[model samples]
Target: MTSPFASKLRTNYCPSDEEVAEIKALLVEPCLRLKGLDDKITALQKALDKLTQERDSLEAYVQAHTALISPSRRLPLDIIQEIFVACLPTHRNCVMDAREAPVLLGRLCSSWRAVSLSTPRLWASLHVVDVGRLAPVHDSSSRRLEERAALIPEVTRTWLGRSGQCPLSVSLYTFPFPSDPVAPTILETLIQVAPRWQHIQFTIPAAFLDTQFQLAAKDVPILKSIALHQYDPFQVPNLAWDRLEVLRGSNVTGVAISGCDLVLPRLPLRWTELTALSTLGSRDSPVSGERHISSQEAMELISKCPQLRTLSVLFEEHGLFAETEAHPIVHPLLQTFHCRGNVSTFTFLPGCLSLPELKEFTFLVHLPGSDAYMDDENGRPLVRFLAASSHLESLHIGISQFSSSFLQEILRSFPPTLQRLRINAMSKIMWGARLGSSLDDAILSVITPGLGDAAPCPCPALKELQIDRCTAISDSALLQFISARAATLKRIQVDFAREVELDIRPSLQPFIETGLDICITHVRPTRKVSAWEGLPHAERPLLD
Candidate 1:
């Protein structure tokens, strides 16, 4: 039997060799199919890349169309120019370093730059700062100053030339004192075209007087306003400024009365002219010498200005007094008088109070630390003079001396035509107290006579009340007053009060129910309660 089995194995009787080949072929068929699948995958990836490119192209086209269809893109060129000019800053700056303005307009499109360039008013105002920063070459600090000085005039001329005959308002500020001397040349050019100049401001150092005077003498009759900063007052030369209406002085460290005197004769009394004068300095500053304008000089100059309506006289170390026996009267047409100084007592000499047309008056009296005029009989005459103004509608009185009697006299004497009343920094007074108990009581007594027949009722015609930094008003008394007079009250504003416990809600509830306006502002005294949230709706601001 073993011999028979060996013979069969040698003969390969189970299956033929061709059957094995067939099995191998079947396994290889699956490998071939996998290779075909990989080829198809590569093709699909290529198709995906093509689709992605097409999608990106479509998105870019849509963005372009959207931008073109925007309303801003459709605005007329003139309107667009107006928008650009509106973006210019009104605040005066010595230098403007930002380049985004013209550049941005230029980059928008060719048409925009054309429109912007054509609008002369768009370029008439020029402000330059740190001209040295625009230099192409690095130089020593001193050299940079020289280069900046030389470049200033050229830059100004270029801007003005582009502006054509349009009026120019130029502000030039530079530092380190340039040796280049271009500013004078530019100013000379401006003087030649003086009629085209409307406004000019200079913040240059005091060393540039010669250049300034030369330009000022050019008789810029069209110049309406001129402002000088950090310059000698005397260096300002006289000109035929028939159209000049406004003159301002800033950072004036040096006083040259000689120049002012020379220019005074040229200033005529034109009814249309209005002047705003201001000076600032400490009592000990050297600038005080130049700041003095004698009463005689002031009167003489003002007499020529018959049409003058508004006058603001501010003095630091001095006061207006009877300097000359002439005692020239102020313009009869004057309507507003605002004066501030250390003078504790000022008497509007017999005819000084002749401004019958005066409407608004503000007087700030600062008492000397050891002065006696605040308490003496000397202030009586001044008080009487102020009380006699019949046309005064708005009166603001600030006193350094806290005297109930003095304040009471003023309130009792004030003109009945008054409409607006503001009291600040007053002492506290008890409600229903005696007249002499506190200054506040005196004030209330003076005003009570003008109110309704009731004790605390406000003036019938009074519409607005503003109280600040005053601790004298009692909550109950104020509430009683408002509740009785809420029909006439329109608006009330309070800030920074000392009495935090005063709850005005009960008194203001009537106004809120009737839809009248009321506003009250105060700080939280402690973290115990939310004062703002707790306030009544009428006293709280409406939020969106």
Candidate 2:
């Protein structure tokens, strides 16, 4: 069998030479196809390169043409200066981060740097809240002070030199420690440059007075407004502020002036030229006893500010003194009075009664002792004072402690000229035996008569009313009263306690149904009620 298979295999195998040649030919055909593909790729690459070169040339031509037609010069000097001024901050911050502005503008080119440097107003307002933060550690404290002192004068000169008599505003605040005696020298330098200074604010610590007396003594002739904090006026004796229009003193401890005692000298009388003055007492100061401003002293100060229009005084305690006498005659030109603290009993002097220009008054009253007076005795004088202001437009009274009768008396005393009224958090009951009766009924009865007839509200000028957080008053009666007088009422806000039901009435249903600006602010079930919540969200906030 093997011999026969070998003969057959040899016969078939003899024809394989042609088949091998055919197989070699098939392998060579694939190599030839690969060579054709390589040729196609080379041609495509050359075409792509030629197209890229042409596109680049076209772009360059277009760019050159565009540059030829467009303006190549820089913006006008005036326009550049205006842009730079627009970049400066308007707010008075203790520290100014303006170091980058000058450097960046300067680096734009030599011309830009010159323009930026030449613009004095851009650099004139030098605010140095943190000298250390602005300078490096290697610069000694003395060197920093000298540098800081020199900044104002240099900038002032630059501004005056460039702008020629343009108004300038300068603000400086230093926190120099007692050991640093260079602050006074710096302040003296600032005063010497004060002729061009329009606005100056100083927050120097009390320690600077120990080093140099001139820190507080220098006279500022062109200074319109000066804000001094933690400074002793006694240290600087000849400090005559002639053109000073506004003077603010804060945390002024211990130091006193020979001519001016504890009480600020009456502006037009003692200082004569003062127009607006503000003396803010710290929260730590005593409210009662001799430490408080005497009623006489307060009157004297008020009288001196002849042209005084606005006055704001904050007391540490509610009642400064237990005086029943009327306040000293206030300035006739006074327009606004803001008193913050627990002053339960206040009497406006006879002169304060007829302030023709008075428009707005805010009183924060806190009654002391259980037997607080009602009727004319408690706060009728203030009410009368308010009533006398024919131009009175808005009134805000915060009554912390008072009886319903007293509140009623107060409402009765309200002037008919009042356009807006607000009653803040006030007690619902006090004095004698009306404790069990509904506080709402008592308040409504007191206020109802003042609301005028059912046809027209009592306060005809009254347009907006807001009531908040008087737990004793029934919302129904309050709303009913408002609805009857709704013709003049525009907005009503009712913020009530969780436990209290509004007890909506049928008459007030129309106001609520008509979508009258009525809002009911309910106290969050788990959260505590805030005093602010008790306040009516109306234009004029009231005490009750």
Task: Please report the candidate that would top TM-score against the real structure.
Answer: 1
Report the number of backbone clashes for model 2. 14
lDDT for each residue of candidate 2 in 199-266, tens digit (9 for 90 to 100): 65555544442233242223334455554444442353323433222332221111112121123443
The clash numbers for all candidates, in the given order, read 5, 14
lDDT of 1 by residue, 1-544 (tens): 2332355556647755885576566568678888999999999999999999999999999999999899987898778878887766577522323365543565667877787677776677776543333343566875666665567667666667777787767755443333343545555655555667566655444445333544332355556555444333345443333323222222111111212222444433232354433232222223221233433445554565566566544434444355433343645776766655444224333234456777777765543342322332445645665556667676666544535656655555566566655555443233533222233433554454344233433334556666666556566555555565577667666554664566878768878788656666666654443446755764644443
Supply candidate 1's per-residue lDDT for 260. 27
Model 1: residues with Cα > 4 Å off, grouped in runs: 1-74, 82-114, 126-162, 170-195, 201-206, 216-218, 229-290, 294-297, 315-330, 349-351, 366-397, 411-544
For each candidate in turn, give its C-alpha RMSD to the true structure in angstroms. 17.4, 16.8
Please give the lDDT score at residue 450 for candidate 2.
52
Q: All models: lDDT?
A: 0.53, 0.53
